[model samples]
Target: MQYELAPMEGITGYIYRNAYVKYFGGMDRYYTPFIASTGLNHKELNDVLPEHNAAFMLGEEENAGSGETPPPRLVPQILTNRAEDFLAIADRLRQMGYSHVNLNLGCPSGTVASRGRGAGFLGVPRQLDAFLEEIYKKCPLSVSVKTRIGVADMEDWEELLGIYGKYPVEEVIIHPRIQRDFYKQPIRWEGVELALQQWERTGSGIPICYNGEIHSLAEYQALRQRFPQIRRVMLGRGVLKNPFLVKQLGQWENRLQATGDAGDENVREPETNEDNRGKQSSEYCGIGGYRESEAGTAREQRRKVLWAFHQELLDGYRKIMSGDQNALFKMKELWAYFGESFPGKEKALKKIRKAVSMAQYEAAVREVFYSKS
Candidate 1:
């Protein structure tokens, strides 16, 4: 199973991606938040600046970086219905040394969809078909599409997938939710079943990737059991809630792929050290090498690594974004998801949310990392 980080508008920017790569690295691919057809703002441009994203790709200028694991590929995504605009963006990215781009037709924001872009484009199959026809003909690099199943129902998804199959789409990243579903629960897996059926019927050979709310290994394993053929999965909000999710999932996937095992057995907890076996472990499992209560040294190491990642974010944001407030704004958006991991830290999280200055944010975050659970 290849794990990817789904492009989220405000989250998953270069700073956050790099922070993730440096600490909890395992993602196979990272998509830059969809580049709006309106064009790149200074901040947005910074996101795709080959310089900022160099670490995610291998064979860079120095080819060495702070990332914990082998760096993953970075693919820039463009959200647009205009074929000309897509060609323009693709040209810019190609000039920037990128060889692959993802077309976004899954963004469900009202402002975006109102403009007949993103998921809104799915409502007009004819126009979407023409748009893909032109771009695929003119684009110089490989093209994949990240798209919703339909506008308000799954009825249109089959036709849309047919249109996609007609093109040389590198891959189809299906969210399985119609535009109206927005971000609701219980994704329409029937839509995915439909895609599989189409592949079986026509043998299009184009790869299919699933994107949804997979928050844990169990959710992912269940997905695999239901559709054992699936090998690629994209994760979004789950990564924010638990940064270690992909690392854990990737380890399982790599093991399965390497061993040729069915990987269907129950996943066991990491074995305790010979000296520490049979000890009562805390409920919390940490990304830090040491986890909860195995030992004092272990807990302190966990805190150190967590703080290191946070400091990198703070430092990276202050450099790229304009002021403390801008950095604070971006960080707070992430905290909405990141804060969920610490179940009882609501008050500490509130302090981080209400933080007005960088200093205040730092103090509150330190409390979050340092406070005893």
Candidate 2:
């Protein structure tokens, strides 16, 4: 199973990606947050800069002489309704050594959708077909599309799939939610099933990856049980909520392989022992089995690791942003997702939110980590 980190606009930038690799590394690929090519904004260019995307080397042998490693397999993503602009930015990325690019058609933000980009582009199938036609004819890099099932109604998916099949896209990532749903309604897995049915029935040969609401090993296992054909998945918020999810999933897979599970058809059911595999605490199990007390110790170790990762983020932002206020703003944006991991952190998080200066922010963060409560 291939795991690609979903491109989250504000949260999955290079800085976050680097820090993630340094601490909890398991993602096979990391998609850059969508870079909207609106006349080449400085911030957008900086986001995809090769220098900023280099991978971090952890151990002495891994570091060797250079101390830095090659970046993860990164596919820069772009959000545009115009084929010309898409091709233009893709060509620029290819020149920068990227071999692939992903198109953002799944973003449900009102600002982007209202402008007839992202999911709103699905409303005009004719224009979208033309856009795909032009890009495939002249594109320099492999183009994959990340798209919602529809714009307003589920019926829109059939036409969208047909259009996607008509092109030679490397892969189609289906989020299985309409624009109107906007991450609120249950993921219409039926829509995803329909896509798989269409592809199998037509033999489109275009690979498909599932996305949306997959946050844990059990969720991923359930998805595979439902659709054994799915070989790739993209995770965004789930990984943000639990940075160890990908690593834990990988360990689970290795355990399955060691148990002689031949293929997707013979994948083992998740352990039924509630005591052994409680969803909330299963992440503490590494390669070998861990006792309940060991799990508690592991949780403490994870907290310390998270603290180090947090400091790396703060230092990274400080170097880039001019003012301490600007840096704090970035950290606050991260906590919106990161805070979900700490179940009873409301009080500490509130203090962090109300912090007005660097000193106040540091003190609050320290209290959050050190507090007995």
Candidate 3:
């Protein structure tokens, strides 16, 4: 099983990816948040600079001052309803060493949807088909799309899926919800499962990756049982709640390979000396090493991951923003997702959100993660 981290705009940037890689080390691919298209020539849209940092930030950099080969596996993502803009962005990303691009046709925000982009494009199949045709004609990299089922209703997906079947996209990532429902509703799995079968029958051969609401190992296992043939899965919110999930999957695979349990494998929690599990066992099942105890190893692991996450936010803030205003804006966005994991987290995050300066933000962060209380 392969895992890709979902691109949550403003939340999943270079620093976030870097921290994820350093601490989790299991994601097969990481995607950048969508870069909005701008400029008349679209050349600026094509210029990969700090804007391109998302694609190159993974892996190790030596000689602090030198530029060398990039280490992380990254795919550039773009959000544009216009084929010309998509092509421009793709061409530029390829020159910067990215061979894959994902179209953001699933974002549900009103401001984005109002422009006939993101989930809004799902409502118009002909326009999407036309735009894709133009993109295929000019793009230099493999193209994939991340999308929801429909703009406002599940009924709209049939025609939308038909349009997708005609294209040679590398992969189709389905979040399994209609646009109007936002991320709060249950995933429309029946629709997604049916589409997967249809896509395979047509011999599209392009892989299908499931996304959305994958909150725990049980959910992942159920999906695995339902679609045993699927080779790729994506995690968005689940990863934020428990960063160890992907690594656990990776460790399971490693254990399988080592034991030669190639088929009908039992995924029992592997027994190990308390010390070798690293971040996975320590943070996942909460302290007692997966044993049935509240203050066990799993809790310890969760605390460790959370601490690392907070420090990275500080590091990323310092690198990207010079003033408290910009840094605080970015930190608040992250707290929205990560705050759910810690005790008294909502109040801790609220304090950070209202902070007016770097000093205030630091005080709040220290209170939440570093205070003895």
lDDT of each: 0.80, 0.78, 0.70
lDDT of 1 at 144: 90
What's model 3's lDDT at 220?
A: 71
lDDT tens digits by residue: candidate 1, 1-373: 7778999988899899999889877788899998975466776688889888868662232334755555588889998889998999888888888888999999988998989999999999999999999998999888999999988787888899899999999889999888888998578989999999998899999998899978767678778889988878999988887776776677677778779774633333222232234444345534232235366675566567667877898898889788889989988998887775555555677999989988899889987777754
Candidate 3 per-residue lDDT, tens place, 1-373, comes to: 8788999766776677777777766776788778776331332343234454554542223335666534546776788998887887676666656677899999999999988999988888889999988887678777889989998788878777888887788899988888898889887888778788788777778788889887655577678778878889989977765566676666566765687553323333322232223434223333112332344455556567767767876687777677768777887777665554443334555787788887888888766654432
TM-score of 3: 0.79
Top model by lDDT, which number?
1
Error of 1 at 71 (Å): 4.0
Reference-based TM-score of each model: 0.87, 0.86, 0.79
Candidate scoring better on TM-score of 1 and 3: 1
Tens digits of per-residue lDDT for model 2, 1-373: 8888999887788889989989987876788889886555787788877787767221123434786644457788999999889988987887676788899998898999989999999988898999999999999788999999888898878989999999998899999999999987898988988999899888999989899888766688788789988988899887776676777677767867787563432222222223333344333222112222444666578777888999999999999899999999999988776765554445777888999999999988887666643
Tell how far residue 135 is off in model 2, in angstroms.
Answer: 0.3
